[model samples]
Target: MSSSLPLSGRVGIITGGARGIGYAIAKRLLQDGASVCLWDVDETALSEAKASLSSLGNVATAQVNVTDAASVEAAVQTTLAALGKIDLLVNNAGIAGNNAKLWELTPEEWRRVLDINLNGPFLCCRGVVPQMLKNGFGRIVNIASVAGKEGNPNASHYSASKAGVIGLTKSLGKELATSNILVNCITPAVIETDILKQMTQQHVDYMLSKIPMNRFGQKEEAAAMVAWLCSEDCSFTTGAVFDLSGGRATY
Candidate 1:
């Protein structure tokens, strides 16, 4: 590991890391000289990701259910044991959920979205922060969405869940402000990913029309931003929401 590498000697854990933006983030972190543990609920995907990423650097995989505290704790232990110490946490696991009117959504539908998008990050932070505290350094980047800021019609559950993530990032950032554990989030309008399959075409076109750039963001683009956020250079910003909305976010 060259000292010139921004993340040399750092270790990171990326939730939902088997595919999409999470997978891209794992690759970027590895390229930047950080060892990473990829966490996801799909065992097959985890194995495949590790196989593909191992040549880039030291990579580990954990089958995790972020909504469950016990599962998150086990993955934390797995990461620490594999990589020694945790320096960065990217809460990238999430779902767009089913696009529908708020009144049409069932209690289970709403809870499912909230559990994975919001509670997952909370559980991950709860489990990983102690190790970071011991190391006296940490970086937490939650993957929020522009929908959280400007609510999307027929996607109330998704919007509200991401809004909760923004709130979590702010609250946690402040609590650990003095502890050298900087926390922040990214609110992307839309990035090209398989997650789009879960959404309706009408919803997708509506989101695309809002982006002044007239195109969807690529997964690698999101990964590049996250790489910087996880690096030592991102020292001054915490509790902030960085927009990757292609001019869709006004504030």
Candidate 2:
């Protein structure tokens, strides 16, 4: 891939695009050549991200609740109305609840984690598929986690939710294989982001012990992979899960 690649005419909608990995994806997409629609739940962060990313290229922003069917529908409609087409969808919004034993996790905690990590993608995909079908071209890239694969201790809900995302990606990718759309998921381990601050110290220590590289994965590393999966070069793969866990995982 060219370091200075361009995605000139494509329109992309990135959920949870206001910051972190989402922001990096949005920035990379714009740098490539796509028109970007940034959707996030935080209004202030959305506005700030819009301003910071405006220097890239054609862009827009929407405060959206990815887990809410109505909110997702409205965001998709607004995107199509303004951009006129939806070529890429990055379902990157997610939440990592406090790390605790499975027995200690409450019903509400499990529901909230699943709502954003798994259900959010369901809602966003539901909102975008019809439009994609009409155009016969769409790229969906989901951000999952290494925990989903190995099942991290004290993070039962998060693990299960990301596991569901992987399952969803595989199912959707096959379901849409006959069409122009392609769906795939990426699992990252110990990314250097604000989300890390939310994890317990023990959680961090345990994760680091497993990461053979003994370092956090950069957001740009993940963004590079996501950009490719969203690009024209991603023609032969769907329903696949790629890993960005440094030396921590290989399968």
Q: Pick the candidate with the highest lDDT.
A: 1
Q: Model 2: how far is 107 from its true place, Å? A: 0.6
Q: What TM-score, computed on C-alpha atoms, does each candidate reach?
A: 0.99, 0.97
Q: Summarize candidate 2's per-residue lDDT along 1-251 as a digit string, tens digits.
A: 24446566889999889999999999999988888999999999999998998887878988899988999999988898778899999999998998999999999999999999999999999999888999989899999999999999999999999999999999999999999899999999988889988899999999989998888899899989999999989999999999999877767
Report the number of the highest-TM-score candidate: 1
Report each candidate's C-alpha RMSD, comma-separated, in the order given: 0.6, 1.9
Q: What's the CA error at residue 27 for candidate 1, in Å?
A: 0.2
After superposition, the stretches of candidate 1 with alpha carbons farther than 4 Å from their true spots are none
What value does the lDDT take at residue 19 in candidate 2? 93
Question: Candidates' lDDT values, in order?
Answer: 0.95, 0.92
**After TM-score superposition, what is the CA distance of residue 18 in candidate 1 from its true location, in Å?**
0.6
